[model samples]
Structure formats: C-alpha cells, structure tokens
Target: MCAKKMTYRDALKEAISEAMRNDSRVFLMGEDVARYGGTYAVTKGLAKEFGEDRIRDTPLSESAFTGAGIGAALGGMRPIVEIMTVNFSLLALDQIINNAATIRHMSGGQFRIPLVIRMATGSGKQLAAQHSHSLEVMYAHVPGLKVICPATVEDARGMLQAALDDPNPVIMFEHVSLYNMSDEIEDNTKVDLKSAKIRRSGEDITLITFGGSLHKTLQAAEELAAQNIDCEVLDLRSLRPLDHDAILASIRKTHRAVVIEEGWRSFGVAAEIMALVMEKAFYELDAPIARACGVEVPIPYAKHLEDASVPQVPDIVAKVQEVLNSDV
Candidate 1:
C-alpha cells in the first residue's frame, strides 16, 4: 500500500468523514464541531461536506448532548459525540456511565448503545487544570464502556471506524499533544482496536504505554538502544479489554518492564498494568516492574510545572535503566 504523510488531526478527520460517508446512521454532535470547525479544528470542513444535519452543532451542554447521543443510539442511529476535552467529559459522566454503558446489560441484551464518544485527553500544551487531563483511566474503570487511545497517526485514522462498528459504547481518547504530530500512513490502512501493538521489538526491557506517552516511550527506547539496552515499546491501543496475552508475552521476553502513563501514579493505568504483570508474569521476571507516571498534581498553566507533572522521555529512560540495574 502506498503511504502518505499526514498529521494526527487530519487522520482523525479522515476517519470520521469515511465513517459518515459509508454509514448513513452515523452522525456527529458536539460544541463547535460544525460551523465553528471544532474546538481543535479537526472538524473544519466536515460540516460543509456532510451538511449541517449530519455534522450537527450542539450547545455548551455536555450532559444534554451526551444524553441525546445515547437516546439517538437507542433509536437505531449511530451518534458520534465529541466532548471537547476530558475535563468537560465529567459533565456527561452520568449519561455515559449510567445510561450509555449500562443499557445493554440492563436491557437483557435487547438494547445496545452503539455510540462512539471522542474527546481530547492528556496534558502537554499548557492548557492548565481545566482543559488538560488524563482521565481515560476513570473511563476504563467502567465495566460496560470500552476505552481506546490512539497514539499514532494510523491508529487515529483507523480506530474510529472500529468504534462505530462496535455494538457497545466506545470512548476514543486523542492525546492533546499529538494532534499536530505527523507520520506516514498507508492509504488503505485499517487497525483493530483490540490487541496491544509492539511499536519496537527488543529483548532487554519492555516499555509499556499508550496515548500521549507512546511517543515518549519510543524515544526513550531509542536512547536505551544507544546505551546497548534493547527496549521493546508496547502500545496498549485498547485500554479496557487490555490484551493480557500481548503484555505477558512482552514481559516474558524482556524480563524487565517499565509501565508509563500520563495519569497520576496512584490508581492509574500504569498501576493497573503493573498489577497485571505481577499477577500473571511474576515468575517470568528478572527484576521488579517499575512505573513512570504523572506526578499527583493538577496540571499547571506554566510549561515547566506541567512538564514536571507528566511522564516524559527522560522519565521513561530513567525508569527503564533503573529496572535494568535492579537486582532480580
């Protein structure tokens, strides 16, 4: 397949456009998503292409629009609800958890909420506490919701279609920092939102991460490679139905592991991955599993403090080295 270079933002827009064109049932509703061209400009020309009816614009009521999306899905329409950012998604938590996520189970499998919710998550752009957050862990904690984070351009372009095809509610988290990042993507590329993908294969240590932290982990792996330490980079594309086999396989081969997450260390995604490793791959380890996570602090507006709060390339590199040097 021929590959073309594109930004993550463009990839996402292409996915939504393709889905909307192929499926008449799929429609988008959110604040500034239509005439305003979206808060992040991902839906810039969508309104014109799909028309205002399909690319609808809603008021600043997250709870209302999100709830409407659930109702629409129940009415046999596939609605793509954009919540602007993860911080604003808190307003629609009730609609998401109580209704969209629980409908299938509560209705005895009769009613399935085939809804897809897209939101920008994580911190890096100095958006402060209100606009920036890595709250996918909270969504992942929900039983009925399937949470996915597309860290690369290819995944960003392909995951939305898979989410739309799902019978259950799927939440797609796009890292705020990766929208402008560009990469080569095949013209006919499609990705499954299921298993963990090994971004880089290696033997010495494993660097596990997803979403915004994937790039940082890859960079750290490159640095470790220069130091004669081969590091495998694992991208957990699907967070909820985590690929346990893929994670375990990586740990079994590498022996040393470092889990990285943009969310806070305590009770975050990184912690969950570490626990999984300890539970299933305990005997296959050479050293204790380490984690590089965001400091337990509200992301600051200042660049320096915000940078200090989240996991970075240096942090991943340091954690990998620490795990490698530790006694088994």
Candidate 2:
C-alpha cells in the first residue's frame, strides 16, 4: 500500500496545495490565512509559495471578506474563504444564506456559486461560547449549499479537492479538536468526498457520527465491544448530501441506531438522521433511534464545563445502550 508519514494537518495542507497548483481559478482568502498562515495554521507557507495574489489575506470583517469571496466566485474565480470559526460565520449570515446560497436557483440557473468556505468549529480548548459551535445543521439547512465535515486524515487531505471541483458552493467544517490527532495517513489514493464510510463493522448497532464527535463514537464503540455488543460506526463524511444508502444499509444490518452530534440537542443534524432513519429504515428498525448531542446551554469558559457541554464517550455509550434496549 502506498503510504506517508503525515498528520491530519499535513494531509489537509497537501490537499489545498494540490488544488491550488491544479486550478488557476482556485485561490484562498481570509483573515490571517495569507501571512499569519491561518488561525489554525493549516494554510501556512501557502502564501509564500503562491504569493499574495492567490493566497490573499483580508481584514477581520467576516461579512465583508465572505461577500468578497462570493463575488469573486460568481465572477469565475474559485475562492476558498476561511472564517476563523463558525461563531464568526454568523456575522456573514446575510452574505452566505441570502446571497451565496440562493444565487444559482434564484437566478433561474443563470448563475452558480463555485465558492468554498472553510471554517473551524466545535469546542474542546475551553475557547468558550463565542468561539465554539457545531454549525453544520445551520449550513446544511440551506437548500442551495453543500456541507462537508471530514473527520479522518485521508478526508482532511482529499475533501478540499473534491469540494473545489464541485460546481456549487460548499462549506467545510474542520473541527479544532481534530487538528493534532495523529493517525498514519495514506496520501491521496483512497479519498472520496461523495460518500460515507463504515469505520468499524458490527451487527448489534450502528453509531452514526461526524466531525469531532466521531472520535468519541469510536471510543464508545470500542467500549461496547468489550461487552460483546458489536457496534458499527458510520462516518457521515458529507453532511448536506448525506450518504443515505450507507446509512440505511448499516441500519438494515444493525436494526438499532445511535447518532452522536457535537451540536446542540435541539434541531441539530442528529435530528435530521432520526428523521431519515424513520423514513428510510422504519420497518427494519428493532428499536427507536437515539441521539447523543451537546447540551442546549452556551459553552462555558471552565475546562470541565466546556468538556461537558459537548457529547462525550460516556454519553455515546449510554445512548447506544438506550437504543439497544428500547423498542420503537
């Protein structure tokens, strides 16, 4: 097998670099992404190689820069706009929801948004409420945009290329907690952005998750394995265009499901999965689906509270058992 010694960060960087090299229309813009190398440093050294013309940096005005990216994209340039965090992306709500999202359909297919927005999301570093959010539900709720949250080393490296290649606008969420988690990465060969992958196989239950919560779901699966409960783990790599086939197939096998989302408990992506499960696999389900999600309260500044605000392994474990025991 072809392989390389790389972290998820390197994988993500290589993906962006390859896209930049292959497409003249593809360029990056955001606050500190050019010289300072991005808030998460994933775009470091890119500005030096591509120069400021392509790897352009902008002021801290999230709404203005986001709108600029939209304009540039509509004008035939593919712009990868980076927001430091999803919390700040809220500041660009009008530009994203009203403009970038609806431009294609609203224009009767005369216009298309070939734009990509990259932003860091979720809580783990005690950054508190202002800096943390799992906004995939918010973005996915929009009809005109595609949302992707890559939780693996290969995806972190490959999804950028796939997102940039797509004809429509896409929003990618890179969870802050996943930046440093090292897994031996195999470069570029096995990556695909259009489908979900079953990370671990089992028949007792299916644990569905994405983004930072994926790690916790896997941990919970491992813990369940010790009890002779085989839990399958399904990574919903692409959120908006969810791999419904993969989800339903896993549900068909397990007949029990638990969806773990790092976002709030109310009206989150987990709720979407529950709806889909009922619609697609209702007859196959042996029990009601369960969701393990973050509390509805704002993320707290304390380290312990911040950790508790989001779903944890124990939360996943309990939810899985609840589904296994409950009858729909």
Q: Between which residue pairs do clashes occur in model 2?
A: none
lDDT tens per residue, model 1, 196-290: 99999999988899999998889889988899999999999999999999999999998889999989889998889889988998999999999
How far does residue 228 in candidate 2 sit from its true spot (Å)?
Answer: 0.5
Return the TM-score for each candidate structure: 0.98, 0.96
Off by over 4 Å in 1: none
lDDT of 2 at 148: 92
lDDT of 2 by residue, 25-53 (tens): 98999989888998888999999999999
Query: For model 2, where is the 10-residue window of minimal lDDT?
Result: 185-194
lDDT score for candidate 1 against the true structure: 0.92
lDDT of each: 0.92, 0.89
lDDT at residue 69 of model 1 (Cα atoms): 95
| lDDT winner | 1
